[model samples]
Target: MATYSSNDFRPGLKIMFEGEPYAIESSEFVKPGKGQAFARVKMRRLLTGSRVEKTFKSTDSAEGADVVDTNLNYLYNDGEFYHFMHPESFEQFPVEEKTVSDAAKWLQDNAECIVTLWNGRPIAVQPPNFIEAEVVETDPGLKGDTAGTGGKPAKLSTGAVVKVPLFVQEGEVVKVDTRSGEYVSRVK
Candidate 1:
């Protein structure tokens, strides 16, 4: 197994800590006048999506995790698991609900998504940055309200509710930013 020293700590770096795979979220180097330099790392456990903070000396090292990210097309959810297919090989697999997590809201049939695998098992799922979904329910647009100044909550076909501009109405397709859950624009 490969090892990562403190110098290699950075956001997105995956390593094994306490027998679990963790992805580094942030790393800060602290140098005090009284003692040796150390690094403070904030990482998320890939298997359970839990966050943890650890301090390491400058010379400390950790084993690298056998993590791989693959692009897969999302099929659908069967209430118990979410199905995905490999684009090239057409091999299909089912991922647990916990592994899909919040990304489940953005999943659409045949949409591309990144699946993180640890030792050949799915650990996490990342939906695309932008998703175009139809507004299934929302207040009717008022007359002369095309200025888009105020916003109202709109429920999407995928079950995610986001604030859309005043001019938006039900049944209109709108693009949303998955990272922040913000409405981008109406799909033409």
Candidate 2:
């Protein structure tokens, strides 16, 4: 295994600690008048999404994590797990619900995503920033209501509910910002 010294600590650097993989969220170097320099690091565990902080001496080193990011297409879900397939390699894997909860709202069949792998198994998934979904159900918009003034909750085809302007109606396709789960605009 490869090792990275405190000098190499930085955001986005992946390392192995306590037998698990972690991504360095942030690292700061601190030097005192009479003490040895150290690096304070905040890292998030790849499998559980938990964060921890630790201080390491300037000469301390950590093993590099065997992590990789791969592009995959969303396949069908069977309740327990969400399946994905690599476009070129045709590799398929099942991701647990807890690992995908954050991105579940934006998931659509055949959608493209980036899957983070640790030791060749999935640890996290990232969906596209924006998605276009059709409204499946929502109350009727008042005749005179405009798109700017007010909004109502609408159910989408993907089963995620989002607030849409009053003018949006059932069966209409709208663009949504996946990061915020907010309505962007009506799809033309």
Candidate 3:
């Protein structure tokens, strides 16, 4: 594995710490008036999503994690594991439910997603930033109520609930932000 020096400490960099893989969320350089320079890094554990902070001296270094992200097509979930396949290679694998919890809500059959692997095992999954899903259920929109006002909860085809504008109706398609799980706009 390659090593990353303090100079390489930056967000999105994956490094190994105490036998676990961590993604650096933020890194700030701190130099005291009389001491050497150091880096304060906030990292999130790839496997658990827990965050932690650590300081490293300018001379300190960390091993780069053996992590890779590959695009895969989602197949289905059997109540226990989610299955995915590589489009070209046709390689398939079952990722644990816990590993894909954050992304499960936005997943749709045949959708392309990025799977993050560490040491040949999946540790995280990321859906597309934006997704268009059909509304499956919601209360009727009131007269004169528009999207600019308060929103209501609507269930989507993927079984995820998102707050959408009053004008959005059942069977209508709405764009959503996967990262924040918020409604973006109604699709025409």
Candidate 2 Cα errors over 4 Å, as ranges: 141-149
lDDT of 1 by residue, 48-100 (tens): 99999999999999999999999999998999999999999999989999889
- Write one digit per residue (lDDT tens) for candidate 3, span 70-174: 999999999999999999999997999999987999999999999999878999999988999999999999987764657899999988999988878999999
- In model 1, which runs have C-alpha deviations exceeding 4 angstroms? 144-149
Native-to-model Cα distance after best TM-score fit, residue 111 in candidate 3, in Å: 0.8
lDDT of each: 0.94, 0.92, 0.93
Clashes within 3 Å, all models in order: 0, 0, 0
**All candidates' TM-scores?**
0.95, 0.86, 0.95
Q: How many pairs of residues in model 3 come into backbone collision?
A: 0
Residue 93 miss distance in model 1 (angstroms): 1.5
Backbone clashes in model 1, listed as residue pairs: none
Query: Comparing candidate 2 with candidate 3, which one achieves the higher TM-score?
Result: 3
